[model samples]
Target chain A: MGRFVSIWFRYLRTDWFSLRQPELKKLPFVLRSPSRGRMIITAANSVAAQQGLHCEMAVADAKALVPELQVQDDIPDLTDKLLRRLAEWCIRFTPLVAIDPPDGLLFDATGCSHLWGGDDKYIEDITRKLQARGYDVRIAMADTVGIAWGVARFGNGSLIIESGITIDALVNLPPEALRLEADVTERLHKLGLHTIRQFIRMPRTSLRRRFGQHFLQRLDKALGSEIEILSPVHPVELYQERLPCFDPVATSTGIEMALKELLTKLCFRLQRGQKGLRKAIFKGYRIDGKVEKVEVGTNRPSHHVEHLLKLFQINLGTIEPSLGIELFVLEAPIIEEYLPQQEQMWNESGGLEDIRLSELLDRLAVRIGAHVIHRYLPDEHYWPERSVKLATSLQEKPSTQWPIKPRPVQLLPKPEPIEVTAPIPDYPPMLFRYKDKVHMISKADGPERIEQEWWLQQGQHRDYYRVEDEEGRRYWIFRLGHYHDKIYQWFLHGFFA
Target chain B: MLPEAGVIMILNRKADILTELQSDILRLQGFRTVNNGLLDADLGVIKQAFPNASFPLSCIHEFITSQQEHRAATNGFLSGLLSSLLGVDGVLLWIGTSRYLFPPSLPAFNLSPERIIFIDVSKQRDVHWVMEEALKCKALTAVVAEVKEISFIESRRFQLAAEQNKVTGFLLCHQTKKISATACASRWKVSPLPSETIDDLPGVGSPKWHVELMKVRNGKPQSWDIQWVDGKFVPIYKTVSLFTEQNQKAG
Candidate 1:
């Protein structure tokens, strides 16, 4: 008597070993074990035929029963590689991927898969593709990986397994399909429980006492009676690189030397990926469960190894590598691609100068912080302050001319307050004092009223005046609109030549 | 026969040629200082005198000390000069004192706010170094420097530097009570003039000056009593009554 060695690929490696065969639909098929001589009759159209085939018939006997049977020898390693490739392809769908055992893939395709149309269409496309490539495929999607696996293997057409129908859909399937061991199932069958429905109908306590709780617990998972989690194959794409040291390297200098090598490798990867890292994180995972992470930030996006090393050099003394770090991983979260403008070189006069300027800007950005250093850009607004914006240096230079207004040579950072005494109707103050100097305006021009941009709440409405003092020093001033019981306030905004 | 005829022709030509030469010399003199003492003078004199000469007029004036108060005084003095310079179109280049000049306060003399250009050198060794370079560019009308101690060698170099490029150079120096034995054509010492009286208030009054021409290359150096008013220098001509009366009253 040959012992049945039921090897379930667990839907994990099906992509690797299963031959593409769309023509095998509703056909009788058996995946036979070449080594152990056991067989899995994966499909049958009717319950009687399935039961008849399940009665421990020999492969030759089963082939005699169907006559038009399809058979395949189980190859595990090939199937595993195929599963891994499928998992890699699933990355294009969603980054979160996990390999489900016995031939299944669990993808957290949330908010995704819509790009390939709806979930049904996405699954249909994948199934059709796999079938065309000569493989037998069954697909099911559910809230839980366990339910999804059970439905794909057992539940046929339109196996939605609606929120409340998990148990119902899984009821008629065999107890063996619940991932129970053959010995356990045979022992349960001796107790007159064969199908999952009959076993599930039996008192939970009796079944637990007779065959242990593992069988029932697995059944509950299969029936969505309990929650199941699919372990993710890859976690979040953290900005980290790691290196394991062969020799337990001690000393800060040794760590620094090792870190330089790691940084070079990491930066090379980043450069190849066209990314400039603003922050570099070097984590030294020790043989002990201790982790030391040292982080440094650049003012601008930078992948220059020397500059990054110099920045890390400053903090080298701070990291106390206690028992020596065995692994080093460098990660950078703030990354931007290096976008150096391609020079036309048509005129060729300022090519060298432009290169020099680019180098200067890069150095400045590294020292000051990319965001902190900005260039003045002319804005379209008529207001003097709003007419210019602080722009990041990396953006393409704007090709706009400066405004034609007679603007002041220097604009104050913020409008200075002025002591003014004026009448209500004409907001322009008659006399104002600024910087502790009183100016009696002999000549005044302007009522250039600028309306507030209502969309921006902090905007102010003002009427400006170009006033000339007795000695002819000109000033630009404005009066704020009156509100509530408050009188209009006057401010010396800028100066005029 | 030719010698005698030539002698008669020469005699007849003498009187006619003499008058023409005299008139030509006179015309040149008037044009020589078309704006006399206007091109090179202190802030008070420049403000009172050449108000219309095109901007960026270089005023060769010196500050006696590097004290803050002295610096402020120098700035105030330059501010008045710049106000006058801005009235015309040209570039004002200040050599040594570039660091001290502020852009905003220079509107008084009408210096085009944008026209003022400043270049500073690390050492006194580079004074002539910049003059030749600056003068080579026709964009600038005036160049000013504070070289209080110019040896004969440096002064000659500077004069040569200015002459080659035909650009006016103002060399501000400390007052030498005794005239220097060098080749500078004119030197003027500017002291604060008596404040002008407007009603009971004293506005910036007539700029009084004791103008001494240390060396006049083509003429004699003499002391002239000059009063700068309405942007023009005029000879005061024995005006002692006003000061005497004010002094007697105070006494």
Candidate 2:
């Protein structure tokens, strides 16, 4: 019960070039490369092909045919790089995607098409998205990859072959559609066997003797008599639970029930394995062929079904079961070993090890981005800005103690320059003006002189002063560099209470 | 018996029963008198204005700050309280739009900055949401949120969560909008006062503030001058009655 999709990029290289340079898209362009001391056309765009120019043709001959044709050197090994990137992008359609190489992509579409609603809409979505990105692709879906590959390139009209009907759908195609060598195809034509339908009924041993074992293997693979395994770009996650509904589920309650069931089953398996999921994705396959998914991430590995469900429930509104969903899949792509701790006898709250605390953090991280929730630890740096670093995890402890000296409670993101009048060279300012307000210094303590870390960056040393104004408000101000010829540049760095 | 004497005795008996009923209602509303040596919040004379002559826990407290200096003073005072509440390994959540609390400075208030998880959100609604959610978790000792404003309903929700979970919440609200009523147990206004150095030293001494209790649910509203000297709040001007109250309870 496996289905496959083959996407043939007819003009992959030129389309990539066009996507990079829009001006070359309309012109008849060919990518030429030097091979065997001769410049050969490696790829030609559709416009160039229409003008009787094609790949493997000499650049000189192409130029002679169309003098106004545009020529550019082909990049070495660009095909493999381009195909791999395209294949990775195709993962959104299914978890399993493989590069067909040279100019094609293979997808294991089993149970995936229903997420997009149906087969027709599924293919339509893929083709439309690729076409929107300025790529020329021909796609075909069938029960076997061989038929999908054959129909995508050579067979014309309605590339999707019905299940159990691939033979009939591919019967009239030419023998070359089986991807045979030149000698075999030529020998077949010489024997007056131009179409596959003409000689498909012949005995297998005789056919093997005529065209060899590789040719029959390809034929049998196309006809579903043999299996072909696709090496996926990214391995599928082992912690995945799937539920197929006997009837379509359209209501929110139904979706919630489906999600809860999947979570229970998944959590039970995780509990037995002594592992927990850090991130999970809940996907529902709609009857209309569209896939709706919601993702939740936790601060720590969690097998708690209720807490995880609460996190997912916050985002369940975004999933629309348009016509009704018929299938659900839950995947835990990230998992970690989680050893359960013993229950507290007196229920004393532990600091970082508290499950309730981590659950709260996880909920907060989901609502507001995870990046916004941070814990800071002191770093061994003299610079004020670099003095603290964000802890990577909850269990991280500070390597160094907090500075003993008094610092401002509020530190500005960047220091604001202030106008100061100091009578002495290194003395604290007598008066300073910030934001059109003047403050008279009543008391001061300063010239801490924190130099910039030379190994980390290059900057002038700052002479910091903790000054108190007549109103009793204290400020941390610094003068940049030296007092250059009796002139000083002071900036207000922070406020202290 | 004479009619007037009998009426006075009946009135005295009725008054005693009424007081007992009132205390019972307060206890049912999540307000229990803090016995001596039961809590560690040594807020000096300021604690006398609470319902039971002790700093209230498991409730929402609102602080209104108009200027940056006032905000700093409030944070310093809050850090002092947080340090005591966060007994050994307890943690606090400080949520706001932008972080200005320098981590290195928290040590001066007896708080390890690492123990405080900072949550910086871009929206005010998110600040309240995080505060409410954090308040519901009993594991956290306290939650502090710096927000522009909060509605009555939102504050009520926070109060309910704190009451149910026994977690303290502090809302550092900016006084940019018109002040409205909220379901907080107490409201405070703290402003910086001139610091006095010991023995007339040259530099600024320990931080001092004018702490005003603007509103309290079932207690007196009063103001006091206090200074943070060596990680504890000490009243600048001592009153005889405050000491006698503590001594009487101790004896």
Per residue, candidate 1 scores C-alpha lDDT tens digits across A198-238 of 76777889878888988777877766557666565653344
How many steric overlaps are in each model, in order?
Answer: 35, 9
Candidate 2 stretches with Cα past 4 Å from truth are A1-237, A342-348, A485-487, B1-30, B34-41, B238-251
- TM-score for each candidate, following the candidate numbering: 0.37, 0.64
Best by TM-score: 2
* DockQ result, candidate 1: 0.03
True contacts kept of 2: 0.79
For candidate 1, write residues B1-251 as lDDT tens digits: 99999999998899779756754774677423324243345433222222222112222222232322233333444444444443444445566623433344343323433444444555555555555455544445556665546666666665555555545566655333433344343343333223233463422233344443333333333344555455444555533322233433432
DockQ for candidate 2, C-alpha atoms = 0.52
